[model samples]
Target: MTEERGDVQELSDFELAVYEAVAEIDKAGGAADIGTLTAQIDRPEEEIWAALSHLVSANHLHSTADGYTLGPHDWAP
Candidate 1:
């Protein structure tokens, strides 16, 4: 499910920020939950939620009972 480079390029600034924040969570061995993301990134909960929703919709992130994580298509270039 690798995503095209064009798909990565199409992300908005906020979406990229959310994606980066999730990556950081992975690096830190933490869950990409709303609370953790809100703390790690300086955005409002509503904004984070919006970005998360968009990321999920775009198949850039996946949600699980543990939390959100990079989707199969979201491997770094």
Candidate 2:
């Protein structure tokens, strides 16, 4: 399954990883902080940050004071 939000036609593997990290955080009733994401996702912190940036820019993720979470967009498969 794929989603289109703003300029995003499809999600790259890295982006999907970042998104899944956030979803896992949500499931645990926690926030998607850099540290937590770093541990949850095998990728380097820089790559995670980059993917987060892309997801945010695409409006698929939003930043809160606590950390990152899904935006208005629905990414459910």
For each candidate in turn, the TM-score is: 0.79, 0.78
- Candidate 2, residues 1-77: lDDT per residue as tens digits? 56555555478977987887897787677779898888877878889889988898888888889999876655462
Off by over 4 Å in 1: 1-6, 74-77
Top-scoring candidate (TM-score): 1
lDDT of 1: 0.81
Instruction: Residues 1-77, candidate 1: write the lDDT tens digits.
Output: 44533377778998999998897786676659998888888878999999888888888888888889877643453
